[model samples]
Target: MAFERNTQETYYESIIRQGYSRRDFMKFSTYIAAYMGLETSAIGQVAKSLETTHRIPVIWEHYQECTCCSESFIRSDHPIVADIILDKISLDYTLTLMAASGHQAEAAKHATMEKYKGEYILCVEGSVPMGDDGNYCCIAGRSAKDLLIEAAEGAKAIIAWGSCACNGCVQAAYPNPTQATPIDKIIKNKPIIKVPGCPPIGEVMAGIIVHLITFDRLPELDNIGRPKAFYAKRVHDSCYRRPYYDAGLFAETFDDQNAKEGYCLYKVGCKGPMTYNSCGTIRWNNGVSFPIQSGHGCIGCSEEDFWDNGPFYERMTGLAGFGIESSADTIGKVAAGVLAGGLAAHAIAANISKRKELRDSIRTARENEKKFES
Candidate 1:
């Protein structure tokens, strides 16, 4: 378990090695800054951090789930994100992408864990099954629980990469057979950031990494440990069809005309109002479209136990909260009325001002006439 951390490499060093220009690296940094919703002034900070900080050593562990998280990482739009995060990322040690197999791979993980102990980042992609002493997941002859504990022991921080690792995902859904467990449930000490989604959006995943690289710290996390920048607003808050929702218009069925007309999907079990994610604003697949934009209701995949939340197509049984259903229903009408009233008030004020001016002129003329007579 004894090892040494990898030397920090300069951005120029990585650029030369990767056959990319220094300009290319800077451009990537700028894109990253923008994607992370950073201010224009923050481009410098992002570039500076990437240029100086050595590539963070990462131990990405996979457990009782599909490899979608890894899949998403490799497909990030930014060239730097894909290259630096997955391909070159594993040039160090990741079980899925690492070329070394069997004992060699195991040895590599151990070496990185030891050498970079308490310095490397741990990226866990799946849930650990605690039942049967963690028999549900075994890697290279080691139980998943044992592997997680061993890997987490020397980590600087942990990133729960998908709903699986963050909230036990589907594997831990209702009547969970294996008793899947999230990272925070087992690893107590490290600062764990949960990027919860069935499979989180690629840029969101990359943005987190960039924020960490740039800020030299985790981005601000909400109560659930998910980054607030991406998970702060409900998907409904930014949906293009939100005005329709506020106007009491809704799509009763997926194929209804209202649906075709881009009416609100709340009637079709759209969880947009309840779920929080950047999907509506940042839309998946290079900002092309998200579920709601593609004529489908938001399944709310980014939330905890979403799979167990019930049928994705079932409408919410009843409206909750006082004004949300009633008052919000008339929002569009209310806003319009207020605007009209404001215009009328301005006109009345203007007319009064003009009348006052005319009266003052007449009085002044009369006073002049009297003075001349005297």
Candidate 2:
């Protein structure tokens, strides 16, 4: 019994120690399981894992990024997610959240790496600069590349937390000065899950970790290494304005009547058609609203190299299936223009036919009068 007492605490035990009831723990498990896209049957499995498995060691490393991933993560709507996953978990090292710094922080990282080698998860939140012998970015007098290589050497898997880590983001945009490179590029041997966005949604981030914790394995990934559960459907599939797009109705401009009436924003440079993210379904700021819901286009922040995709206000031109030289704006406008022209032509023809009938009747009346006079 003393040996059992010395055993590592499971996730449920940790939370319960923090004053959460068993009912609350079960509810929290069910909630996170749903977020992980697990069915009702799997909720029991998730709860069991949380109740039995010890906390996995996590090493969160920062490179060249805005720390928005951490910012977004801490704002998760689920208290259990923020507390259990982010706060109470065995997160041995993180530049942003850790209390220690300098020598103490480096020692903690090394200790965890040594103790949990090949068992810990390494979460990278930014790009690694290789230019100038990696002089562009440094931490504790070591190049970003050296730190990444050392950390990734013993990690069981790696999770790239944002666009900066997954696809180099704006730092790797055209004419990259620092030669910022994504995690996948720098570390190729290990399994890497890329949760890409300018900053991905908070719940989605939690769901990925919950999936890892519950299943003790990685979630099914897409070709680009993102979780299929969240990135499977394009934002266009679940967009509220999809029917308008199908019917060819679109806002011609941002301030137009169609825009005010909640028409599709495809014409106004919305990237929902090409962007694969859960923003439309999951929303943001605790489901308050996403960019599209807030009257702005998606800007395709989740896609790779979105910074170089061209002007945000100008829609993509020359789409293969669109049949127009420009984007949805041109197609919608051209279709509307054609419809208006057809209506005008039809009205003119109808009036012409009516006038001819009137003239024929008048002639017939005049002829009948002449016949009667004769």
Candidate 3:
């Protein structure tokens, strides 16, 4: 059976029907606003929008992926985030979460697409396999590529969830037998928001949806189509061990005493310095901890082509405009050399000034002695 809903029902009405108080709704708004880096004034705006706006119809698609994105989204730290965005909201069709399956599921998806054409958000959770005439991955006897094109034609926008949908993840790695292709590559006309991670932070997933629901528009994106609010800073910039990195105190190995003392993990193949994400700040598992906090170095999962970038346990030797083969340790060595040279020059200049002072004193003494003799 198709899951039915009242098309005119607002989000707040649904929340209230679900037994959430106005206070709970406001609190959720505040929490989401904070996560979005919105000003305090915007909390009311967010609340107002959610209260009055009808829930957006979302058709979430699954393709060539591990389904980690779905796992992460449902396990969002905030119970209400999962409840409101996934359940109360008009998530009309999702292969993984919906009760309807087989023909019933297909019926639900097609109905939403036709009824809400150019309005419903098409959320794709994986990549499309383009190789072998798109035969590697199929759903309902159709290639993922064909289904994606059909769905995207009527979508208001597309949310490419996780690295798989954003950048083809592991399936698109070396030799890519399936030739997995990201949604953005397949859909050119639509506005696609890329949230890239092995499985992005659950709160981040919720925040993006809330942003869309609040503003009736996509959040401000960076150069690569990722939301700026969460991906603006590098993980290294907010990492707790940043001080150790600046002081050149790095853990040489995962089991070293320096690691126990909480030194920077840069030398042990930490990719935090190169990775842009909110992991250091927002954290994972309801703000309890993330990879870095758990003593493992960041694997730089958010960046494009991360699987092909380099070995996970090795630090990046160079980034764009950083000079070829120049690692952090090399830069530190050069900085130390410059500091030593500057100190030596300062000492030499001080010595020269002292000698000049001595010469002047002797000249004054000689003149005084000559004046007394005369």
Each model's lDDT: 0.83, 0.87, 0.90
lDDT of 3 by residue, 1-374 (tens): 44477767888888888889989888889998999999999999999998899888999999999989989988888778878788656689988888889999999999999999999999999999999999999999999999999999999999999999999989998778999999999999999999999899999999999999999999999999999999999999999999999999999999989999999999888899989999998999999999999999999898888887766887765454566577677898999999999999999998887998878998999999989954
lDDT of 1 at 263: 95
Q: Pick the candidate with the highest TM-score.
A: 3
Better of 2 and 3 by lDDT: 3
Candidate 1: misplaced stretches above 4 Å? 1-6, 318-374
Q: Which residue pairs clash within candidate 2?
A: none
- TM-score order, best first, reads 3, 2, 1
Off by over 4 Å in 3: 1-3, 316-374
* Residues forming the 10-long window of minimal summed lDDT in candidate 1: 316-325
Per-candidate count of clashing residue pairs (backbone under 3 Å): 3, 0, 0
How many residue-pair clashes does candidate 3 contain? 0
For the record, the alpha-carbon RMSD of candidate 2 to the native fold, in angstroms, is 10.4
Candidate 3 accuracy as TM-score: 0.84
| RMSD of each predicted structure | 13.7, 10.4, 9.0
Give per-residue lDDT, candidate 3, residue 287: 93
Question: Could you tell me which 10 consecutive residues in candidate 3 have the lowest summed lDDT?
Answer: 316-325
Instruction: Give me the displacement of residue 77 in model 2, in angstroms.
Output: 1.2
Minimal lDDT window, size 10, model 2? 1-10
TM-score of 1: 0.81
